[model samples]
Target: MAAFPHNRRMLLMGRHPPAHPCEGTFMSFVENLIDQVARATGLGDNSRKFVGVLASYIFSRPDGFKGFQKLFQKAGLGGIFESWLSGSPAMRDINAGQIQNALGVRDVNAIAEKAGVPGSFIGTALAGALPLIVRSVTAGGTIPNGLPSGLAGLAGKLDWGDSKVTHLRGNRKRGSFWRWLLPVLALLALAYCGWQMRGKSPPLGTPAAATAPVAMTDGTAQSVGAPTFAFQHSGGKVDVSGTLATAAEKFQLLDALKSTFGSDKVTARLDVDASVKPASWLDRLKAMLPGLKAEGLKFAFNGDAVKLDTTALPEAERVAVSAMFRDQLPKVKVEGLFDRGVEAIKGLKAGYSASELTEALNLTTVRFDTGSANLTRSSQDIIRQAADAIEGAPAGTRVEVGGHTDSQGDAARNQLLSEQRARAVADALIASGVPAERLAARGFGSNRPVGDNSTEAGRAANRRIGYEVMR
Candidate 1:
């Protein structure tokens, strides 16, 4: 929908460039373009290097460049590529949806897995750089032939660090000064604009002070004190202390905390002033029971504060808990909690029955790759903890590793995938010192979904590996 600049040189280059000295030229152009994008997007050193790696991988695909062009055109983002090729100083902004559309969800997930970065971060980096990279490589207006066919070959030929970029300087054959100078100037201009806008913008993560009473919908002004909240994580638990004007507000805060820190890991002590009636608070908290239960979180309001505890959770479950709170509730002061280590699986009673161990394992978060039987790197810790618990279970107990899938593709395929996933988990457990004879793998497919298959959240919930005791 947006208009973009068009490069005359690219228009003449066609769809594929011939193999010649320009191979290095093409590679150099992409390297420079990546550097420019990194500066523009404010990517850190590691992420910037990742962008280079991703570019090499994409280009190495048999039809990667052409595929990207087609994908962009299909997603209605052709204009961005046009603008980048035409050397437009203004970068076109692309959203996460557009990135997902341009690069299929599966491909994006694979890229995220291969890059070892969050999918969200991958989307962001690609959105910022993909157009420019495409434009640079196709500058002669064609996908260059004789390029490396894989990331290893491409990376071997290219330098990722401070080595200077050479070749692919466009029509000018002599000087490289203008080519380097223009991007630097563009970056400075963008930086200056950002600085000029900073004064008018409110600081992030700072809560506004409540100076006046909040007016209620019932045409009444509640004479309430200012709301103050703080959260901290230590010894495998998050401690929340806060004061809110009403019980509804308290419930809202507690719900967010529970979602972020996993209800089992959150311990809240919140106070609702006497100005708000107790009945109001009780009703609100009661209504949230189902949602809390679904998330496996615990909530209770004590005399002074809302007591929340997540100390029993594994480390992987608590990942990104603090970030979620900071991003969603920036005003709430959080201390001693900046994404730390996971709490050892404590509180598992010795000599616990197989069923009890299964229930506890269900509470732990175990993640796997999208559409792959391989367990995610993050799931290792959780599986290890489960193995420890299983080892402690009664001698005759046998644990079932049950895999389930959302109703997305064919039922037959889903069934097979689920079975493979279940087996993968069993294999992992066996490798981690759990006796192979004590564990069995089973797949339920989409038949035994615990949540709705229509919604993404429900689908995520349904696609899980469940542990069941089958003594």
Candidate 2:
């Protein structure tokens, strides 16, 4: 639901906008499946309750998945998630311990109490049910970012608020595998028929490709009104409406929109909240705006994830733009990001030497908030992956963590900030299990410059965390 007033020039975009009403049917299916899973396994009386709680927690807030993934990586079980993340037909098996590591003890205990079960029961049920939940909901092997089709409006009706540690409480009496089996089979058949008929002659008046579902968070209980941005492009006009954390960021984004599309054609409904922290993708989005002029496009930024619909674009164009956002916002999820022309790139190999680790780390630098040592959300995956690489380094090899600042501020303060930033990264590494004795933290301040200090890009390059093999 978007509003655009004041300018009445109607857009001639295709009839199919990004709306799907049949979503509740899909959610009902999920509920039934969870009930069946619990009863079939005979785990316990409340097994179904906790499993349903976790599933609802995931469905409503997909961005928390980054924390889930980071937890797995910290526990050295990150690779086991590849199958579910990739939406592979057969998901990898997980265990109670792995689930425990990912959800943590406190959260599990909270969900357990809500479900009237022990913490161990929550972990054990989730271990069996998590894979099922992931694989079943994935659309076309790519996870969809928003709630299931039509599920947004139904979230409250469905009792999906588990915002207390985000673990919702609910009750379900029964699920018949036999009853649910028919609908699942029929949908599968319909999907199969559609696949078999791909590239064949189409019926008259084919609908424009379905745009990605738009789930604009209206600042839910857990969302904390943390910056939301969404735009829809159709017939040469753009309609935007979302909450921004700052007026400055709001102005910058609106300016970017005007610059991309003519100023007169932009219709915006943006609100600014100075108290909330700005979204991590704001700058990248402003820079990427010009390239998003594709017809019939929809871009939604909710919390720490993005859902982009390029159905109106060709394979090359869609894949290129999607991949660009994907690379730039590694810490955020890009839903079902187009499926064509993308080749998987490998990450750091095991048993890396200190120099090799430094080289790899440099390729993707860790960034912090302006004038502060707090790492931005976008730097999280880089830190997580770096932690993994450092853990795999040869024994006795020592690495130094160095932070630098540009020449924009007072040199003394810059030096102090640099030291704090370096120490922050070192502590993060230690938290991720990199031994403290094997690492050293230091600050270069404005002294070892890698890029020109006068320009913005150069300053960004200069203000970075660098790694070196300690001699």
Candidate 3:
């Protein structure tokens, strides 16, 4: 991976202008996550760097912070996490054992690989560096919607206090010397690597060894900008997450999943959001579960379209099965060129920008029912223009639907509303024949404001939705 440029100055969060896309044009999504997390955590230790990779995997979701918080908080470490941000000396240090315990040995080892470090080094590095990390992200006590970008002029504007914890535990025990210390250090250095990997812990486990023959994941399918899924299946275990269009669909889908995967193996997170496009593929979905007997097989479903992913199959098999699926599923519109690659969205204009698309969308505007994602008739006609503009800019463009709101009511509700509204737009585009993979949706709450939040007009403007071309 090409390393992002680093300088003496750190990008601290405060009342600065929103970070613009043009600022860091060279960065990729995962790389940006790594860079931001690295910057946020002060790049304390190489082991700690993997947290950036881990963060990328989790925070890639439309509302990523939810999973990020759940990763630790669900492990019953909420208070310990809080102390890390306490900004006092009492902030505790975790051990390699704790990192193993929290993330599990398997995930630690996998993260070690991603970070390009030995497995043993990761646990200790995180144990030593996480406290400083906690302080950086919660800087000024706000978790940002979009990843931070600009770092040029916005330094020292907000001097929110940080954790008082120091990295080196230099104090010596009453009579202890290097004699005792060296042995303990050596043990930590070697022991973590020696331990047998325990696969698949209940908490945010990834890449664990699974003896079971079948591992399946069923989650919400979304575009690049909205609430997408990140699933880990190992040792015959299953994980289900992401939002759904309706409760009935969730129930039917869960039943089919449990029946096929065995009830004991299935774990699910099926959130219901009315704004999601109602499942047009559900009638075919139940029948399809039985066909998941093959490994490395995945499917992407959007609206009525159901596309099979045969990337894991042999080249001949991949081509043959895709043809079979194409014949079976009429809505899939499976294009061989896009099997694992990007192609231009048909009819999209060339070199479109978000600002241009937003303006064009405004002319024919897609409007939702007040405070809900339900589209009015006015929104229907705009999908074609919006869809084309989305993928029109970059070749093989992937776009995100960013939902915004002006400050009006509860901030939390506003955030959810924005997400729903974004999805609604995305759904319309998908139903209108834009490729499902190219679009994503997310809500920005009231954090981004165009006009003054106090004014009704500004709030209305803030409650708008826009698109971004993601690389």
Among the numbered candidates, top lDDT falls to 2
Query: Candidate 2 residues 1-471, lDDT tens each?
Result: 332221122333423432322322344444444554453223434445655555556644435445455667778877766565532433454655667777677766765665555443455456545655554444344444333322223223233344322321222122443343345444533443343356553211111232322454445443565677788887677778777765456656765676677643565556565666688888888788888888777877777877677877787887667656665776676664553211110254565567777777665555565678987554555566677777788888888999889999799999999999999999998888889998899998999999999998798779878888998
- Provide the clashing-pair count of each candidate structure: 19, 2, 8
- Between prediction 1 and prediction 3, the one with superior TM-score is 1
Native-to-model Cα distance after best TM-score fit, residue 382 in candidate 2, in Å: 1.2
Q: What's the lDDT for all of these models? A: 0.53, 0.60, 0.49
**How well does candidate 2 match the true structure in TM-score terms?**
0.39
Q: Taking the tens digit of each residue's C-alpha lDDT, what string does model 1 give over 322-427?
A: 3332232222222212233123245666766677677777766555656889775445656777788888888889989999999999999999999999999999
Q: Rank all candidate structures by their TM-score, best first, as comma-separated numbers.
A: 2, 1, 3
Instruction: State which candidate has the highest TM-score.
Output: 2
TM-score of 3: 0.25
**TM-score, per-candidate, Cα-based:** 0.33, 0.39, 0.25
lDDT (tens digit, per residue) of candidate 3 on 257-356: 6677764465555555556766555666567556554445555444444434565656655544553444344443332312211122332256655555
Off-target runs (Cα >4 Å) in candidate 2 are 1-288, 291-299, 304-346
* Residue ranges of candidate 1 with Cα displaced over 4 Å: 1-345
